[model samples]
Target: MTLDLDPLRSGLHHRHDRVLIAAVAGGDTAHRTYGAPEAADAEIGSVSKGLTGLLYQDAVDRGEVTPETTLGEALDRPEGAYAQATLGSLATHASGLPPQPPYGGPRTMLRRTWRMWRHGENPYGDSVDQLLDEAADVRLGKPRFVYSNLGFALLGAALARTAGTSYERLLLARVAEPLGMTGVSVPSTPRCLGPTALTGRSKGGRPHEPWTGEAIGPAGGVRATAADLAALLGGLIERRAPGISALDPAADAPGASRIGAAWLTTRTGDASVTWHNGRTGGFASWVGVDRDAGVGLALVSATAASLDRDGFAGLARLRAEADRC
Candidate 1:
């Protein structure tokens, strides 16, 4: 089906070299790809966390865990500040954890920054064991809304450990397959990135290395095609997705008035947009749903730049169409 996504395209501002837009209204879904094949995969960054949120809720339903379940219990880690944080707290970014693993010294920071700027190298390449080691000696502050890659990394590990599987395997079995997102994957190594993987670019158009890491898979390592993400959103809109309740606001979040797991619900006009955006050193993506209008929209760009504004604009356009229908 042909979709007039001109409003969405205009919002792009010609900043993206490769773009994909998809929207679903009522029972009709459409997707369009520019500068890339429909099956090409791009990093979805923190959108992985939003998907993990669904997994967390699904685990709860299966009695595999609870929101109150401590990371220590699931991961079998020793009692400590990091391990003691609840799964729910991590899901909602209320774990009092820092954004990423804290690295001391200016030298480390400068080196990391230089590598990213010069080589477009991935800053995250740690394994699950490495991530756990870093969390071991950490201290946590009072729980509040603080986006934490570290917290999500551990959350995914904990969930996997409790399920006697790896994070990628668990995701495939529980989330992707169920939602008809076969193209979605959390590649742990560069070799795992299939031929359909699209190389990402910086705003200035410099090529970037794909961000791949076992530990980061739960937080920001997801890659998917336009169709896969649209399917995910459609499943959520139809209340057929596992952990559909995760879309409901459960706690306060920054920017958005409330958050459900990793999804942020923000008031825009007469609708509430439950959404999450992702940015990596290479790619950017946004996915949102206007539940009241039964519309879901998603955009993926193979460039390390912002797509949130365009995504919202696209979603608003789709919602308007739905209203008219």
Candidate 2:
């Protein structure tokens, strides 16, 4: 069941796709469509959360923070009602924040968007700041996995304030530079294409304006190369990426069979390896390693989907084969 991935690369790139791979185990690095001499780059969508997670980890390493930290304790008041969450909650999608712009219509998109800008482009697209303006009222009543972009946005804001600097600077100073992840940043253009729908194909306006407006910047605003991700993955195995094993979850964090901090720990069934996969608009990617075998893999693609049974199987086989190296 070992997969070579060369044909996969050819199939993707030949179909006008862009692909990149860094086999940490074999020291094999290839950029099929975009390289230093070529022309293409990976468009990481929610994958950016991993980068944000890494920043938070660096904050922890500096003893400036902890996963148990509450947003209220981190940020000063006057922002107002949404606190009670933590870095772990935001990174793990358990912060109970909304998925997209709270409300919108295609007809109203432009007008409301302008309004959002006028409102300071808050990621919540509402008076979420006002909600958390006071620490006394904000509640940690209950917690659930809401896949919160808003929480990450707030966490990034918190990180910036704690470091006494901007979020972008925090990223470079604490993350990108340390990991040698050059050229990873917010994309100049939108992350994905407009979906084909009307009703409007989805709710909370997700599959629309993901990066539009200003507030959700911290949630999914990042792009990086497979090579850089591979190096970062190496840090996981070497335990240098923030000096914590990306494979190990914190005591209070829920146990996950797949990943810790934007990484997948194990693939089940016929696949007996570990990896982390990502899907962005017009792009799909995965990176993982056979922890037991000391072999690693990184992959990138242009097609995005959720239930890619075949894609996952293909990646497992590819990684398993590479794991032999």
Candidate 3:
């Protein structure tokens, strides 16, 4: 069956800044853009967690770790909440970890917000050591589907430590390089950003800080173009990416969706759409695939206007449109 691209194209044009939409079917690929077409780098927020989940699965397959391996065994931190949490639980957001670190209190959040608006400060400046220190007092809650950025952060750290490298390098070597995703990266500093990197803005029209740094890279520090993200999604759909099974649904989630390692899965007729979305202070992103339809899509926008909701809606519409084709 043929694939329809008009719905996605129109969707991108209507409600986003510096938008990019990409889709792939079989060996054919297409891209559409609006506003800053040249802006290829935008923060991908928590979608980074999905990629991190893939990396964790790869590590497990290679025997570098195991699903049963506890965070304490992996990170060598035998005390506190993370100690008893397993790698599988962390990747699936079933680790009973909170959403953020204890140090991210109200006062710290306010300061971070101020810095974001005033100085474009990188809110995630704390090093991995600092993150672990801050997490020392954290108490694990009942194990269920609680999305935890801190859980992903610690998972990435443990994986990196197991490989004796950083998360950025690990992602580059294992995922990006393998998939030819040259545009996917974690910028070390603001100065390292590309010329076309998007400037993230706040809801109040003020420019906010770009989310970067090592501590948060695993949770939400990726930057990539629509083309790159489309390729990644296609790779997963075609089973060209290692550990692609990580995208398979493992448990039930909110909104009648199923939770995979880090992806959300929903059904549209006979097609299963597995997706993950991202949002930073200034950018939003969504990537998904309908393997049965041989279609995969990626969307990125420079505006931070809660694109997650819009993205899901758009994808559902796009899926319906594709069905008609």
Candidate 4:
């Protein structure tokens, strides 16, 4: 059975400046575009973390590192809260790290938001070194299923250090290049300034810069097209990616879902849906796979508002429809 994505297409156009939706089922692929051409790139936000998880697992497969490898050992840093955290813990969001660094207080966040909306400033300006410095004093709490961007940033950094390369290079070599996801990349500058990049907007309707820089790249910095995302998801579903173990359940998350190296899985009827959603200052993205149905889907929008609710609802419905086929 073919999937009808018209409702998703309409909703995306109404809520975003540009949108891309793609789906793959039984080896047949299809897509819909609105307000943007298929090649236009949009930030994938935290969805990048899911890719980072793939990279980490690839490293594990090569024996470059192990899931039990501690962050301190991988990064060669002195022992501390973050150092004691294992790679598996970080990937599963059980490292006890906070959602963000402590330096950005409420006032700072407000100022950054204003600058982003008014001047199109890239709010994540800290360099990797600077991020490490900020993370030095972070007091980790007890390990649990707490989502932490800082933890992911550290995980990406550790993975890169283990391979003696940069995160972007590692990802490109191990994941993007292998999967034929040519449009997936970490932009060195504000993507909003690029000709093929879509203009992003704040939820309040103010134009904002597309996310850039390496500070948040691992946690949420990927810019990609719908085709690239569909290819990546398809690779995961087909077991073509090297780190297929990343999709295996690692820990429990909220709502009875299982977390597996940044991918979250929840039962939808007799099938399981593994998915991740992302949002940045000017973009939102969602990617999911219904393994039982042999289907994958990706949605990207040029908007800052969270698309988690709509994305989950749509993907669940799509999965149900695919099952009926």
Candidate 5:
């Protein structure tokens, strides 16, 4: 039942300067990191949203919240159209929220560009209170398949507020700790960066600042080692992970026909792969599983590039190999 990941790793190395690949097929597991330690931390970008989805489901299971729970109820906000959207809608990107709070106007765009080009700073960093303030006075679009970072940020805040804890602690208690993902974390600031944290780079090889902030943590601030993330994939595949129900499809998405919480399920060859990918200023990651086949793969890179196809290919290969076994 042992899996061969060399072919997949070789292909990934061709596309990325630094890459990490981990796989589990038929109860066998393997992981390899190139130009980085297997234990080094890397930004997981919007993959954090997938984790948030898990938190939402776990809250549902605990009777603290339900899919019908509105943002206004969880966040204690005043009645408004924007706050009327349910947590389920937010989890599935059908909440009609924008990708993020609007930072319109020429001056704001210029400042954001300056920070990114000059200092590699993340412009999305905001505190929970700040994000909540932005949610106020915002307009909602028709509920559809718009991917939203703001919706997730607000969802995380709502979940935390309902539990009477910070999102960081809630994530730890409800997901990371239970799953033994010690390397996974949502850092509030750059000062909390781990010593083993890997520095990511832009496509042009320019180093970028780590994406961190309490407000954005649920949306894109998660970081983890390859080993830890791979373990997470394994937990999900085994259905032992808390919030495992998050993988069940609840809406439609682009590319993937069905969306579950934050995971996307798409048919690749004969297998239905449930997966999520992430990207930050400099880092990219992809995690996928064919639950029926009990095979999973997680790939991370320090370079900012798409890894979706590579991840899907890797998982397929693992499933194929498992079939032979």
Candidate 6:
């Protein structure tokens, strides 16, 4: 099924910007976009962590690792920063970590993460040394929702270690390739960003970076086309409510709560959906699927919201359309 989504068409219609919507359900795929580009690909951001969590689960289903795997042991680091954290804790965002790094620039973010792992505040740091230091010095409360990028980043590292390969390799071999998502990548495939706020032709803006490659691979670096993301939604939705649950802050923490990985899980009547949206400087995208109702949806926009919930609203509308379909 393609999509019965004309009502939810580009709420923001303009020149030089766009939105794409794709859906799969009852054995069909359909997609549409505004400002569509032949090479329109952008990062899924923290949604990458959720995909990493799903990959970790896939590993468990394949008997590669158990949910009980200690963070340190899982990554083969006995005294690492996140050593005391467990796989479940990381997956659930109960590991005490700050939301974003102390800094904003990607390079600065990496440096600050290392510092927190070493000497600064331990909350948002992402380096091995900084994490080890923080892990030794700080202890998170049991089962409390901490919503942390550091937590998910550690989980990504653990996944790489479990797969005995790079995070990029694991993402490609286990996810993108298997699903025929050549347009999807944890490490971007020929990544580049245009000069615009969500794809506008704004002048004087800098050309954006390609998400930090392997550096942010697990956290927020997966780039994908709208159609490719719809395929991923298809897979996740098709496999929903099974022995697997994607790491979603909205799902793990409900009621418009602030949580890590910034994903949302909403249940409508008998149907439950897990979803997320992504943005770089110039593009935005959303992808989601319902486990029980067999519905999936994808949306991408060149122009984005300063707030990210627009994507969620789009998906909600998609679900609403499905009610009629």
TM-score of each: 0.95, 0.69, 0.90, 0.91, 0.95, 0.74
List model 3 lDDT by residue over 1-325, tens digit each. Answer: 4445566656553447567777776556776666665436778888898899889989988999998998888889997567899999998888899887777665375587677667656667678888898898789999998989889999999999999999999998999889878888787667667887877765555676678678889999988876677678778878878677788888888878998778888876666888888877777778878877767777777776666655656656655665666
Q: lDDT tens digits, residues 1-325, model 5?
A: 8666678878874548678778989998787777776678899888899899999999999999999999999988866446898999999999999887755554353586588777887776678887777668779999998999889988999999999999999999999988888888788888999888888887677899889889999999998887777778888999988889999987779975699889888987788888899988888999999999999999888988889889988888788788887
Question: What clash count does candidate 1 reach?
Answer: 0
Q: Scored by CA lDDT, what does every candidate get?
A: 0.86, 0.52, 0.79, 0.81, 0.85, 0.58
Taking the tens digit of each residue's C-alpha lDDT, what string does model 1 give over 1-325? Answer: 2457656766686878588778888668877777888788889888999899999999998999999999989998865458789999999999988887754454354576588879898877778987787668777978998889888989999999999999999999999999999898898889999998998888778888888999999999988888888889889889888988888999988775799888899999888999999988878889999888888888889988898888888788887776677
Model 3: lowest-lDDT 10 consecutive positions: 8-17
Kindly list the per-residue Cα lDDT of model 2 for residues 1-325, writing each as its tens digit: 2324466555343422345555544444343333222334454556566666777767877888887887767786434455567766766666666543334334233565464444323133223243233123433335665555556667777877789876666776666777776655553234332221111001112233323222344555555666566666576545566635434543333344544554445546645455445553345556555555455556654434331344455455555566665
lDDT of 5: 0.85
- Using lDDT as the yardstick, the better of models 4 and 5 is 5
The stretch of ten residues in a row with the least summed lDDT in candidate 5 is 101-110
Number of clashes recorded per candidate: 0, 15, 0, 0, 0, 12
Which pairs of residues collide in candidate 3?
Answer: none
What does the lDDT read for residue 274 in candidate 3?
A: 86
> What TM-score does candidate 2 reach?
0.69
By descending TM-score, how would the candidates be arranged? 1, 5, 4, 3, 6, 2
Report residue 32 deviation for candidate 1 (angstroms).
Answer: 2.4
Error of 5 at 67 (Å): 1.2
> Could you tell me how far off, in angstroms, the CA of residue 55 lies in candidate 5 after the best superposition?
0.5
1-325: candidate 4 lDDT, tens digit per residue: 6656677676654667578888877566777667888688788889999999899888898999988999889988875457888998999988889888655555365587577777777777667877787688789898888899889989998999889988888899999989988877786566324577777787777677767777688899888887787788788889888687888888899998998889999886677889898888777888888876788888888877777766767776776666666
